[model samples]
Every structure is written in structure tokens, then in C-alpha cells.
Target: MNLTTFLVYCVIVTFTPGPTNIVILSSVQHSSMRQAMNYVLGATMAFGLLLGASAILNRMLAGILPSILSTMQIVGCLYMLYLAYQIFRMGSAESLEQHPSGFASGLLMQFVNPKVILFTLTVIPSYVLPYYSSPLILMVFVIIITVIGFLAFATWLIFGSVFRSFLLNHQRAANTIMALFLVYSAVMVSGLL
Candidate 1:
């Protein structure tokens, strides 16, 4: 693989705004850095697991990718909509108290997050597999991708931390914007656009 191309794809996908990142930002804004970090840890684990699975099952998945992708898209879209609703309703820290942004929620979110699912599924085959077939190499790539993902989540958390005051002052507006972004993400990934 062209290292530059692979790095670019990985960075672009993970760093871009998505459901996970939005939630991380929201978590930091509404909760605490500890909560955001917990979510990031879970997300990082799930990301690594997905990449490992992709690398191991590349050939088998190729035969059934269409079915899998369609199913995932449906599930992912619905989940995203649910998250959007939750975000839309979270106007205050009190409201967010009931909302879960912990490790389990973060792990579950990745499984149903289209942006993450698609990236994990495609990145390995498109970039890593083509260039390296060794299990060791594949594992290394997975670790690298997971680290990138962790960094992306961390960046979002830091952003929210930096703007916590503004976000708290405009809590309703911030929630609305994040909710709308999640909705837009859902629509875009639903194959309806």
C-alpha cells in the first residue's frame, strides 16, 4: 500500500464528524472528561476488534458484503436516529444524567455506527490486505488504525472541553446542531441520498 494514501484515508475517516465523535463531544460538554475518556476507550477497543475481524475474514466477507452492508446500513441508520433523538432532548446536564456515554454505550455505538462500520470493513481490504498478507502485518495495521481512531475521539473530546463554557451557555442550540448532524449522517448512510 502507498503509506501516504493509507494514512490519508484512515485520518480522514476517523477525524471527520460522525455519530461517535458527536457523542464524545456532547459527553464532554454535558458530563466530564472522565466519561468522555471511558467512551473513547471502548470505541478504540471496538475499532480494533472490527479491523481485526475485517483482516481475518476478508475473503469470506467479500462473498456476502452486499447483504451485510445492507443490513448494517439499516440498523446503523435507525440507531443513529435514536441517538439523534436523545441528543435533541438533552438540553441540560440534568437531562444528560440519564443518558449513557460510558464504555458499554460507546462499544455498542461502534457496532451500529455506519461511518465506523463501513470504515472498518473497507479499510483493511482496500489498503492493508492488498499490500500485506501476513497476520503480523495485518495486526500492526489494525493497531495503527485503532490508535488513529482513539486520537480522533480524543480530539473531539478536547474540542468539547475547550468549548464547554460556550456549549453550556447555548446548551439547547448545541444539542440541536449535534442532533441534526447525526440525523444528516443517518440519511447519508441510509442509501437514501
Candidate 2:
């Protein structure tokens, strides 16, 4: 396996604007940095599980259960729309409190996240290990990707957290920005479906 190729994949996947990052950014803007960090942890855990499962089962499953992929895509797209709505409806940052349940909610959200699952099932297998077949090597690759993803997502959350004070000062403008993000997410999801 080429380390450079894996690193490139990690950079691309982690840096892209996706549902996980969107949620983290919204949460940080509305609540606290600590809550956003919890979300990062939850999302990282979920990504790890998906990566591992795809590494172990993607080949057999792809051949036998093609419908499963379609189902996942639909579920993921719908969930993203729901998340967008939730963000669009939220009140100003000061009125919103950090919820303890956000950690679990963040983790579960990744399960239905089409992009994450697709990357795990396709990109990891195809680009990361085009010729390699060793399970240990694949597992190591998955772990590396997961770590990179965690760091990248955390960076976005931190950006939101650090700028939250500025957002709080201009409540209406901040809400408008978030509402636009919701619309953007919805449009992206519709394109996917």
C-alpha cells in the first residue's frame, strides 16, 4: 500500500464539507465547544465502525446485497434533510443549551451518512489498497483514515467554537448563515437522491 495515496484520500475525505462537519459547526455556534468536541468523538467512533465493517464485509455484501447500498443511500439522504430542518428551526445561540444526548445522536447520524459509508465501502477498498489483500494492512489503513477524519472534523468544530462569540453578537445574521447552510445541505442531498 502506498502511504501517499492513503494520505491524499484522507485529506480529501476529511476536508470536504459534509453532514458531520455541518452538525458540529452548528452545534458549536449554538452551544459550547465542549459539546462540539463530544460530537467529534461520537462521529469518529461511528466512522471507525463503518470503516471496519466495510473492510470486513464489503466484498461479499456488494456481490450479494446490492439493494443494501441503495437503501443506505436513501436513508442517509433523508437523514441529512432532517438534520438540515433541525438546524434551520433552532433559535439564537444564547437561547440554545448544549444537550447531553448530542453525543449519541452524532454517532447514530454517521450510520446513515451516505458519503461516509460510500467512502468506506468503495474508496478505502479501491484506492487505499488496490492490490493488497492482507486484513492487517487494511485494518491499519482504516485506522489511519479514521484518525485523519477525526482531526479534520475537530478542526471544523473548533473553528465554529472559536468564532461563536462573534456569531452570538449578531444573532440575526448568524441565524441567516445557518439557515443558508441548511438550504445548501438540502440541495446537496436532493442532488444525491
Candidate 3:
């Protein structure tokens, strides 16, 4: 088991920009830290669950993951569009109110995120299975990967927090930019891009 290689894979893939991280950053910039934290928790927990499922189901899921992922991608695309609309609407409102994304929405987003699902499906086979065969060791790997995932998300939140004040002052511009990002993410997720 090359712990270094496995950890490196986890860091690179989990930390890369994706729907969950984008949403988290937008949520923190436009909403609040507490809301962002809830989102982070939801995304991270669902991601962890997906990792475990992928690891255990392994070959079983490989045959089916494509179809499931397609469905999820469609759902994810629609949801991302909706989120974009929501962000645009929030900015358009005469009085900007914090309509932070909730836990359930966050959780659902993760389930539908192709990036997460595919990452899990591949990671288990490439990193965990070869290195650790026992169920116990696999579970430990899952836990470790999940923590890494959480930390990756936290980094986005921290980054968004850094821009909160600027976003507040430039609400309309910020919202527009963020909403466009969501829209782009939707297109990418749906394979239009």
C-alpha cells in the first residue's frame, strides 16, 4: 500500500473545484458561515456514504454506475440550473435576504454530482482494493477519505469567507458571476460542455 500515492490521489481529486465546492463558496459569500457549514456537512457525509457504497459494491456498481450516473447527471444539471436561477433571483430582489441552501438540498446535490459519484467509483478500485483487502481496512480508508473530503470542502468555505465582504458590497455583480458559474457547472455536468 503506497500511502503517499493514495493520499495524493485523494487530495487532488477531492480538492478540485466541483459543484459541491462551487455551491459552498457561493453560499458562504452570499449567505452565512453557518449555512455553509451545513452544506459542507451534507456534501461531505453524502460523499463518504457514496465512497463506502462504491467500495463495498465495487464490481456490482461498476456495471450499473453508468446508468445511475446518467440519471444523476440529468438531475444534477436541472438542480444546478435551479440554483443558478435562485442565485440570480436573490441578487435581483430589491431587498437581499439570505436564502441559504439547506441540508437536504446540499445532500441531494452530492448524490447527483457526477464528479463525486465517479470519483468514488474509481477511487475504491484504484486506491483501496489493491492496498487493503480486509473490510476493516477498507472502512478505515473510507473514513480517512471522508475526512479528506470534508477538509477539501472546508477550504472552499474559507476561501468564500475571505470574499464575503466584497461580495456583500457588490452583491449584484457577485451574484451574477456566481450564478453563471453554476450554469456552467450544470452544462458541464450534463455533458453539454
Q: Choose the strongest candidate by lDDT.
A: 1
lDDT of 1 by residue, 16-119 (tens): 45678768877887687898789988988898898888778873554456365455556556766776786678544333333468898889899999778877
lDDT string, candidate 3, 33-147, tens digits: 8878888888888998998897778634435563544555566567667656766665322243443576776788989997787677766665455445577887888899999
Off by over 4 Å in 1: 59-99, 161-193
Q: Clashing pairs in model 2?
A: none
**lDDT (Cα atoms) of all candidates against the true structure:** 0.72, 0.63, 0.69
| Model 3 ranges with Cα > 4 A deviation | 59-100, 161-193
Best by TM-score: 1
Q: Report backbone clashes per prediction.
A: 0, 0, 0
Q: Give all TM-scores, in the order shown.
A: 0.65, 0.61, 0.63
Predicted structure 3: lDDT = 0.69
User: Candidates sorted by TM-score, descending order?
Assistant: 1, 3, 2
Model 2 over residues 1-193: C-alpha lDDT tens digits? Answer: 4455446545645654466766776777666777778888989999999988887785455457755444544443454445445544545444444444267877997898876876676544444333454778768877988889898888878776654565557656654555455444434333342
Residue 83, model 3: lDDT of 59
